[model samples]
Target: MPSDPNRKIDIECDVAVIGAGTAGLAAERSARRAGARTLLIDDRFAGTTCASVGCMPSKLLIAAANVAHGIHGAPQFGIHADKVTIDGKAVMNRVRTLRDEFVSSARESIEDLPDGAKLKGKAKFINRDRLEVAGKIVHARSVVIATGSSPSIPETFDGMNNILTNETVFELDDLPSSLAVIGAGPLGLELAQAFSRLGVEVIVFDEGDAVAALKDEDIARTLRGLLEREFAIHLGVKVRASQTGQTIELAWSGESDGKKRFTHVLVAAGRLPNLQDLNLASAGLDLDEHGTPAFDRRTMQCGQSSIFLAGDCDADVPVLHEASAEGAIAGNNAARHPDIRPSKRSTPLAITFTDPPSASIGAPASEDTIVGVADFSDQGRAKVEAKNAGMIRIYADETGKLTGAAMAAPQGEHLAHLVAWAIEDGLTAMQLLDKPFYHPTYEEGLRSALRQICSQSQVSFGPDRDEGSVPGV
Candidate 1:
């Protein structure tokens, strides 16, 4: 293969996938399994987003920070010990060591693809049915766009290169003494809390009042208070930053005013889809008002039947699992001689890896839904662990079917998974109550919320009712 963009070489495949990230890898594997002669293309074969930077690495760092935090707070258990010291460099090295293992595992999964099955190049649409990649033209029956996304750095902070995003933050060999994290979204909150626990003087600024896109107001408020006790949180604040000699100066408005300096600034504002180099207009696809390609979220199909999209490029959901599911749907549909029936979408699950993690599953709060809440302040397991600091809120439809849930509590990630599964399986509040829960466990809080909802339901429950029976049995 030549680097020259003008050199012409023609290749053909039943399915052509762009970008070798999570969604692209999934699409390529699915398309091949569907019997398509798939050609996977990307400018680089770096590991999937989760393994490389997004989920896995962040969680590793959070795990290390949590250990340090636990030791510092160990006196609450009446176990007096010597002062705990943290080695920032050693902690980060451990995170990187484990992160590299995850990335290597992901890379190994696709290493066996045949020589001609994959191409390294930046691909652009020659048309709906063809793409130009590494000076080679690929003609394919169906095309999948899985270019993923990049950190969204605003133009105002263009010249200062010391700013960190999730993409680069984990690579730090030594932690900064002070950090100013802009945005209270999952990435921002998770990293802020992680660093704060590891002894960084963290200051968080979010334009929105909520943290991690939490829908339940009470949970959001509780989370804000909990995080504020650990770090300086300035919510509903508009922030501007500039490099000031050896430090970064942050000026904000809203709850507070004036300027502060930090050793480093982290911009976890959001993400932008990697769409610019695709030349999507050549394929006759128009971008939406948000500047993302027009695609049906349910089917992951672009405006043209032959073109499809998955993962961050779709811009509907950015989680790794959601991207993987969308990739399967897009790949199956693209590879099928005549398109198969559309697959059902998975229940939405979002988790922030902060201490007393916050999570939301399925639909957000709305007028039609009944809400139930359980505070962790008195939760048995949480109290025993000295981690009782938040709450769990569940929502059900008028008919009592579980619809959604939001939680800011210890082991919330596990609870969110249970709620998401139940909602996906169409379980009702009463039905969820029937499932056996261990005594004095974190799940008991979830059961309490379910009981509250069931008690309020117009339909009576009975042992005779089946697993997903409606409110009245």
Candidate 2:
């Protein structure tokens, strides 16, 4: 088809997705699967930070840091390392290369969309079922608001020029000699560990009880111990103010003492949605007091049925996986329109990529008689690789059903996926115990944890048990 230059190029689609992020991409894919014409748009590059600057680049840095740690500590594994040094600049170069590769791949994916799928520049809502993109008005039967978020910067901080957000961290050519990570959430802790291992003087501060505050206490305690033992951690501390005119001036108050101190501060507190630029009021939508789009949970529909919310822009958990899941649900339903059916979302599987990495699935915490542990020290492969530094914990009910689980180890991220599958599939503790797991693999840790749980259960309800022996029975 030849270009229609004089036609204003205004297009129509069954569904129009506003962000080309993980959720937006998943939504587009689902829309195509449902045979809907989908048009995806973004203000910057189509893909969000996870692909361009956030998760992808951060994990690359983590992997490089881990390699440096392993090489520097090789003597303990009976390997001779007469010379062990990490070139910080070189490591950062590799991180940049990897991030560029991801950006390229994301661009290719967007360009390769099928005929029914189209990509465009900045899109703003003109009215319900209508959006203005690149000076042209496009109409859709339904719209999906997947516009993602950005780092939330404190207004009191004066050194905005020196301070950097997750989106800008990957652009650094050299690492800072000393870094003060302001928030102790997953992002803060992850970066602190990575930078500390890479020879940066890292001081992490958290006003919350601990990093990953929403996680279980035991996990938080274990992670706190690991970070404190390896890096500097200051909990229950608040940054009163910061000035970046020359040396970063940080005014902070610690919990125990009301005394204040000054230091260089790096703020990683949290993120706010990118709602202002969208001109949502033009489409008859208003943000809640918290500035998030107030929408129906189940349907994700905004004030108007044709406008659906997805990703961090909405009030759901700001996880890439959750965003993608919501995007697909919202996109598919919008594309199908009148014939739409209810979409179901299973429990979210997530992880914190620290030195040991922490993975979790299902409810926040599990209270059951059946608890299991699999230390990395016992894993034959981890032992062989000399990376035995963490453990896997599992919780189950009285019926031997898997409830919730978490793992801290080099394979924490990978192992968490399997546990997530087991929990989501409703596999009982005994069933997982019987399932075959390959030897000399991180997955063996799963078998080890379940085996321990079985032994504990057996010991509790031993062979000598009689019908009248236990009060519960």
Candidate 3:
């Protein structure tokens, strides 16, 4: 038999995964485990975003900054340090080293796969069931898109020389003398505090009224005020930016209006899904108002088709854990297409790493909801450590079941998890109060709020009225 002239490959796979980020790796692994001939494809072969730039690298920098901040605040405990300094080079060296280790671990997973099960170029859909990668052709029963997202930069600020996004900020030789951060979201606020505490004059700007995307007006107000004392932050107004010479000038129109030039500007405004290179039109997927493919959130199925979408590309919940869970759903379902089964998503939870970290779980309770609040200033443990600041709010239904909670308190991350578990288990505020809370601990603060909630919730379990919802995440 003679070979066909148009044939580029004899590849036939049960699943084809695009991109090699956290979600893509998960999908490929899951599909392969399900006895499918999965072909993993990636352009750069980089690892998870958290390990590379999003979480680990940023937290490493925050850890160093917090150490410097702790030494400066030692006088509160009647302990004075003669001198404190942060070695910028040393700080970055550690971040890069640990980050590389994570990337290397991810590479090992790819290396374990057979050579025929992986592809090393960009893939574009040639038709409904076939893809053209580089110059080769592949036929797959189902496709999983996990290309992830990239930093979103405003068009007006394009082609500027002094602009640095999260993608490029960590590569700097040393911290900038002065830095201006755009966007007061989680990523922006985290980096702003890190830079400011490390001796960089940092200012943050965001048009939104809230910080860290907090919906509870009470918590948002308190957290914003606390963060303001730590560094200069301007919110609730548009920011004007331009480049001149070797620096960038930032200006905002508001009560705190001023134009200042900075050595570099970090843009954490938002992230855009990485779908442009895939030529989505060839796949013939149904598009929504934004020209994005319409898909079921629970099933990850695109327009009742075999193709699945996952991770940051869907922009549903961009957190790392959420990405992994979504990947598993898309992967497993793709292995058995046309028989999609909806999977229940866990109770929504989000946290922003700051001095007194901000956290939110589930959604706000209904109109008949009873709210409980705990002020850290009055808490025993907080006062003893001089970290007494911020507030925690818990919302319960009339039957005393915990619907959601929000906090900008010390150790809010741990508190958020405890609340999430209660919500997941359908435990009422009264039931949570039944559990013992140790003395003088931050968890006690949570119990304080739960007690307040139980006080207002006297009715028995009943039918629903309002479906609580979370915003901006």
Candidate 4:
């Protein structure tokens, strides 16, 4: 409803949800399911980061790039063809076409809601139990903050209109002839490789030693080496950029102290929570040391009993699945009368979609953990596929429980999911080894790593014998 400047209208709801992204949508559904009269509010665009720009669109581009890469590498598999060329404009058109479909689907979900359930305006906290949205006072019993986040552009590139982020990079009609990608995080690496494969001269710069926030040092080193072979990578360096007449010039120091020119620059540094205009002080909440409202990560509850924070707004976990889970928990709690309890969290899993994908799951390797290694260079399926260039490392505790795993290999996503499930189920290395492993498959590499972990474990598997036989028999 449009705001009336003269007077404010009073609306009542059992639960109020802010933002229209994945978390907010989930929160609204969960609140309604819990028998609460829910109101969802979003001032900005309707589509989510994933559907619009973050995950789906980026993957669409990567899929096109992968096809181009496959055709070029077909000769190694004895499937040679001439004139393998990529049309940058056509590739982007396909990405945008698919991306729009996903966005439309997401928008349809919220658009189908009942009348008065969704509001199109920014909401501010008038008081602990009241919100000012479009000059209407929302008297909600409970509130959920799922406002999400936005890309964090470096202060150094403040006025550079040509700099592209994930939000704008996908909108490009034609790929740049040369690109400089700042920040070697997941988004940066994914897009960098994708552009390079599509015939763009790409260079990636990171202030950190590792890319994609990889926890395992060995796996990070291996992945870095592989990426360096494809694109010019400068790690552990300070990068400076300047405009030089329709061209972006980048200079860095560390392994290389040289300046290079690029047609465009993409900044994939990080993200900032969308919380500044929420007027949180009126709700009796203050930003914590991290400049986000203090909340219990397990419960998603803010200091105030009636308010809860979830998703990127809480800054606990940024992945889509985590956001949905948090929203469900927050919504359920918000709909309840009293006595809010904490919810169980899922096992951590991260993936990077490079040619040989990188994946990590569960707790990071520590001193209390035993490490097992398997090189894909010797794995059967990887050799057969001619993509044998990475390794898998699994970690187990002293008692043989699967602690964590990291892999930079073919089908790492599937392998990571398997490991994450095992870890979440509290399975040990021996139990994982006992599972059936198909012959000559990429999963066999996972089996090999588990076997190594079992060997290094303190727990002993007594008398290697068939399970069909009894002890007395």
Give the count of colliding residue pairs in each prediction. Answer: 0, 1, 0, 0
Model 2 spans with C-alpha error above 4 angstroms: 1-10, 114-119, 256-265, 285-287, 295-299, 366-370, 375-385, 437-473
Query: What lDDT score goes with residue 58 in model 4?
Result: 91
Candidate no. 4 TM-score: 0.95
Q: Candidate order by lDDT, highest to lowest?
A: 4, 1, 3, 2
| Model 2, residue 129: C-alpha shift (Å) | 1.9
- Candidate 1, residue 152: lDDT: 89
Query: Per-residue lDDT tens digits of candidate 2, residues 1-473?
Result: 32233444378888888888887887788887889888887766545668786789999999988887887888887888767677888888999888888888888878788774675678876766677787777888888888887788777674445576687777778887777787988888888888888888777777777675436666677777767877867788776654545446555577633323323346688888877767676677767887666776666666556778888878577888788778878877787776656666776777888877887777655454477777666567777776666767787776667878866676788878877888888987777755665655777667656756666564333464221211110
The estimated TM-scores of all candidates read: 0.94, 0.86, 0.94, 0.95
| lDDT (10s digit) by residue, model 4, range 247-346 | 9888889866879988889999988899987888778876788678888877788875789988888877788999999999899889983668888888
The ten-residue window of minimal lDDT in model 2 covers 464-473
Q: Which residue pairs collide, candidate 3?
A: none
- Model 2, residue 300: distance off in Å is 3.7
Error of 1 at 114 (Å): 2.5
Candidate 1: the clashing residue pairs are none
lDDT of 1 by residue, 1-473 (tens): 32333445599899999988889988988999999999999898888999999899999989988888888888888877788888999999998999999999988866878778998899998777888887778888999999999998877678885788999999999888899998899999999999999999999987887788887888888888888899988888888888877688889998788699898888899898999988877888878987688877777787656888999977788898889998888888889835655788988899988878899899988987788888888777887788877988999987789999888899999989999999999999987887887766888778667867877777665777433422111
